[model samples]
Target: MNVMKRIAQSALKKTLIVAMATGAMFSTQAFAAEKVYRLKLAETWGANFPIFGDATKNMAKMANEMSNGRLEIRIDSANKHKAPLGVFDMVKSGQYDMGHSGSYYWKGKVPNTLYFTSMPFGMLPAEQYAWFYYGGGMDLMNQVYSPHNLLSFPGGNTEFQMGGWFQKEINSVDDLKGLKMRIPGFAGEIMAELGAKPTNIAPGELYTALERRTIDALEWVGPSLDLRMGFHKIAPYYYTGWHEPGSELQFLVNKQVWEKLPADLQEILRISMKTAAYDMYIQAVHESGKNWASIKTEYPNVKVKDFPPEVMDALRAANDKLLKEHASQDPLAKEIQASQAAYLKEVRAWTDISTKAYLDNEAK
Candidate 1:
C-alpha cells in the first residue's frame, strides 16, 4: 500500500508538469499571431489637394484591407502631425513610419532628390514610370535615400505640367527678369538663372499670395489643380510647356520600419504603390482635360499661350547647364541622371512611335 501511494504521487506530479507545458505553448502561439503594427504617414499637401490626397487615402485603405487588419496606417497631412519639411527627418529617426510628398521639397537635404521629382524636359509620366519600375531608376533612388536611413517608392507622376501663370505676357526671356515666381526643384533653379527669383510656397498659401500680388508668377501644377485653386481669377497670362515637363511624387518609408515588415507585407506595399502610380497618373490626365475645357469657357480673359521658341530654347539650355553642375558636385546625381537618360533613350523610341505620333496627328 505504501509503495502504491508513492507511485500514485509520482504519476500526479508528471501529469501536472505536462499540462503546464502545453498551456505555455498555446499562449506563446496566440501572442505571436495577435501581433499588430501601426504606421504614421505624412504628406506635404492638405487633405483637399485632390490627386495626392486621394492617393494617400487609397494607399492606406488598401494596405489595411490586404493585411487583414494586421498592419494599419494613420495618415496626416501638413501640420497634422508634423511640418512638411520635417517629414524626412521624422521618418529617418523612426518618429513616423512613412511620408508622402514631392522629392523637390527635400532638395536642400539631398540634392539628388530632385531627380526623383522632375527634370526640365525630362521623361513624361508613362516613361518616368517605366524607368523607375523596370529601368533601374528605383534602385538608384533607393541608393540615394539609403544613407539617410530611408527607402523611397515612386508613388505617382503629374504628367506634363504647364509653364506657369503670370501677371504679364512673357513674349521673351527678358520678361522673366525680376519676376518673383513660386516654383520649386530644378525649375526654380532654372528660373533663377533666367533672372527670376523663385519662392517656395505651400499650395494653401498660393491663392492668397497670387491675389495679393505678393508674387508675380506662380506654378502650382497642371490645369486641374490651377483651376481648383482659382489661379485663373488672379493671373491672366497662362503659359504652357516649359519648366516642369513631368512632376513625380514619392512615398518615403523609414528604413527600420521597412526592414521589420513581413515579406508578404513588403510585396503588398510594392504592388499597391505601383497601382497607385498608374491610377493617379490616369486621374490627372482625365481631370486636366475637363479642367482645360472649363477654363476656356469660364475665364475668357485668361490668355493661354505657349512659351516662345527663343524662350523655350533658352530654358532648355539653362536646364542642361544646371544638370551638369549638379552632377559634378554630387556623385549620386550623376548616377541618377545616367540611369534616367539611358532608360529614357530606350523608352522614347516606343513613345515616339505611339503617343508622340498620336498627339502630332491630333494637332493637325
Candidate 2:
C-alpha cells in the first residue's frame, strides 16, 4: 500500500511540473509580443486649429485606447514643424510616421493629389463619402500615393466650403477678371483660368490681408469655421460655394511605418481615422447650421449671394477646359476624371431622387 501511494504522488508531481512549464512559456511569449509601438505624426494645421486639429487628436486617442497602450502617436502641428505644405514630403521621407493635411495642398508636387480633395461641381459630402469607400476612390488614391511610399486616408471633411467673402458683389463673370483673391489648391487654379489672380495666403495673415485690402477676396471655410475667423466683419458679400462642395482633408502615413505595425494595430489606426473623419463631418454640419443662424440674427448687414447663372456657366466651362488639359497631360489624370464623372452620374441620380425630392416636398 505504501509503494502504491508513492507512485501516485510521483505521477501527480510530474503533471504539475509540465503544466507550470507550459504556462511559463506562454507568459514569456505574450510579454515579448506586447511591446509598445510609438510613432510621431505631423499636421499641417496650427496647434489647436479647430476641426482640423481635433481630428488628429481624436484619431490618436482612439488608436491608443483600441490598442490598449500598444500604439502611441505624438503629434506636431504646423507651429512645431513650421512646414504646412511639407507634410507629404515629411511623411514620405519618414521624418514623420504620419501626417494630417489636405491632399490638395500637395498638388504642386503630385498633381493627382488634387482629385482626392473636393472638385468644382462635384459630389456633396455624403456622396463623396460613398465614392471614397465604395466607388473605387480609395483604390485610385492608393495608386497615386503608393509610388511615393506613403498611404493616404481621409482625415476629415469640411462639408460645403463657402465661396470667397468678397468686399464687393460678383454680378458678372467679368468681375472675376483681374481680381486678386486668397485661394489655394485646384480651386485657385480654376479661379486663375477665369482671369482672376489667385494668391495663396497663410491663414494667420488672411484677416489682415482682407482687412487692409491686400486681397480683394478670400475663402476660408463655411460658417462652421469662418465665423471664428471674423471674415464677415470685413467682407459683407458672402457668396455661396461651388469650388469645394465637400473638401476632405487627408492623413498621410509612411509606408514603412505602416508595414511595421502589426495587423491589429494597422486596423485600429484605419478605423480610428475613418471614425474621426465621419465625426468631423457631422460636427461641421451642426456647427454650420448654428453659426449661420447666429450670423443671420446678429449681423443683418451680411449679404449672402449665389453666383449668377451666367457667371456659373463661365466658371463651369473654364473648369472643364482645365480638366481636359489635365487629362491630356496624364493618363492617370484621365482615368481619375473618368471614374469621378461616372460615379457622380450614378450617385447623383439616387441623391436627386432621395434627398432632393424630400427637401423639395418639405419646401411646400
Among all candidates shown, the one with the greatest lDDT = 2
Please give, for residues 1-364, the per-residue lDDT of candidate 1 as tens digits.
2456547656755665586777734344433333567888888888767987877887877877776665688888886864876788888898889988888888988888888878888888878877787888888888889999999987777767998899999889999999999999998999899999999988778999989989999998888678888888888888886667778888889988988887878887767777786777788898899989988797778898998899989888998998899889878788888888888888899999999899999999
The candidate that achieves the highest TM-score relative to the unseen native structure: 2
lDDT of 1 at 315: 89
lDDT of 1 at 196: 92
Q: Scored by CA lDDT, what does every candidate get?
A: 0.82, 0.90
Q: Estimate each model's TM-score.
A: 0.90, 0.91
For residues 148-167, could you state the per-residue lDDT of candidate 2 as single tens digits? 99999988999999997999
lDDT of 2 at 212: 98
lDDT, residue 357, model 1: 100
Q: What are the runs in model 2 whose C-alpha is more than 4 Å off? A: 1-29
